[model samples]
Target: MQLSSFKSFPLNTLGRDFAVGDIHGMYSLLEKKLVAVNFNPQKDRLFSVGDLVNRGPESSRVMSFLGQPWFHAIKGNHEDIAIRSATDPDYMDLMLRIGGAWLMDKSPKEQARIRQTFTALPLAMEVQTPAGKIGLVHAECPLDSWDDMIFLLKAGKQDALHLEEKLCWSRRRFKDRDETLIQGLHALVVGHNVVEGMQIMGNTYYIETGAFLLDGEHGMTLLDLVALKPV
Candidate 1:
């Protein structure tokens, strides 16, 4: 399903652009947050660091938002797991345990459609704002070069396990690597690992505040790249 390792968005041309963390089926909270921020469905764009479904409620409904022009998402680990469970017979129970049982509630046709959509999601998106460039990832990116990682992903060189493991399931780099200088990257925003608040490492930022927990000062990072604050 033609996927690009990188996507470029002109954040300045749009009314505004915001990056959000994993949803895990918390559509109601997402909606409320957007409304609070006055997210304009017609002009504003919302990018999700992809774990859009699988834990809270209304997974299918959240998937429907993909059809909207305002919503864009990268492939998160949960989507990877759901795709594997749908295609590989052995992973169904594992999917359910990790919050994919919502898939079982849908019809076979619905399931196929969802799988097709999630499977085609891009692994990374690069936003070129007037301020600087921001890269979106579901989990931690490879420790070294963003360019090298982009090349591997753009070429689609990974096997199924590696694809899921590296792009979706990795956190070693985030924990173990030194915050060295990064090239061609103004900021990197990611989800997957829940953070108490935004954690800044080198040029990277982790904004996954566990919105599914349904409590506290949450709702991901609503960033306005010009000022780099929540807009």
Candidate 2:
């Protein structure tokens, strides 16, 4: 909602600014990690690459954090589905199949609130941090050119799906990523494509840890934008 992009929103002024990995119902794990980092919510802030719901228990609980001033998230593929399936039965099967089963039990009012929350989420966010200028997207950013990706994003929705949907669902940029780089970008952070851990390719960082798998080794990958390291 902050016009998709922002500049000079430096983290130095805050307690500590962090970009968290895809939180597929890993709220407790995220809390633990934040505690470990000594995150002071009163002064700190968090930016999420969406997918805050689905594929894990307590997706509903995650919604509680959305209202807090310290938290922000972009639209994720799972959220895209949740919004679509809210009114259209066509997406119901796939939505549940991909971790939207929680929606099935929600009251109509609760479901509407969730839909409203997600529908308001931007497809991407760009900010200037102490580390550098960072761009956060649910999936990929045009590794070849940020201009190409921004063009599509600013133009808004499409016929079958919005440009945001394409951006939120893409994984193509990661293939052969060794050869890829976003010229002037300091870091283009993303989730959606789960990895063994946080992997950096050129200036792009892929941090989806698949916390929903409930694997002991997997949890949210919190990027310390202030320190430019994973916390």
Candidate 3:
């Protein structure tokens, strides 16, 4: 589908979900963890916090899955840079240094698939549940002043600003526990910074388990939103 067509789908109503952290191209590990938790793709929705590609061996596989009807994703910093590089000539080299090289190595068919998928991802997603609304982004929000995330999203403010740092690269939101809590969103789910395991600071959860086996770990963190449990 075309990029515009992809974005035209309804938002603000993704119900009963599983939000996953940065996959970083670890397709096999992702599959294992999904099966481990008995994930039902048809009935249970899967949403990615972004960074679905790069840093591992299967960018192609990652892109293909993200494009599936059952899967949804936000635009992490890696994806932001990639989209920019794909359209901007000057930034192409920088993008390659930060995992674009792996994407570039894929076959023509794979490359086309990846481009189509990434081009369709949103910068963030708002999931509405019976309890409350949850904001899913690649990195946490910085200002902590905006009470209405939906307004910001509609105002075209979701794109990373020059001083804001890319959402995927900012450490400010993760380091300050008090700041995050004060923001007052029911829950903020993010990936990008890998912790020893999943982290819970107030209602916010960070699930970036470093799925690429970066430190030789064997498991991928999985969050079951409907059941409110982690496996």
TM-scores, all models, native as reference: 0.90, 0.87, 0.79
Q: Which candidate, 1 or 2, has the higher TM-score?
A: 1
Could you tell me which 10 consecutive residues in candidate 3 have the lowest summed lDDT?
1-10
**In model 1, where is the ten-residue run with the lowest total lDDT?**
214-223
Worst 10 residues of 2 by lDDT: 1-10
Listed per candidate, the RMSD to the true structure in angstroms reads 2.3, 2.8, 4.2
Instruction: List where candidate 2 sits over 4 angstroms from the true fold.
Output: 1-11, 151-162, 215-218
lDDT of 1 by residue, 1-231 (tens): 235555668765858888888888877777778888888998888888999998777676788779998888999989888888876877887887877888888899988888888888888888877778888889877645677767766677645337546777788756764475556788888888887777777887777878777443465456665555654
How far is 117's C-alpha from truth in model 1 (Å)?
0.4
The residue-by-residue lDDT of candidate 3 on 8-110, one tens digit each, is 1233253446777788888888787778767777666778888887778787677778657778887787776776666687557876765668866768676
Candidates' C-alpha lDDT: 0.77, 0.77, 0.66
| Model 1 TM-score on a 0 to 1 scale | 0.90
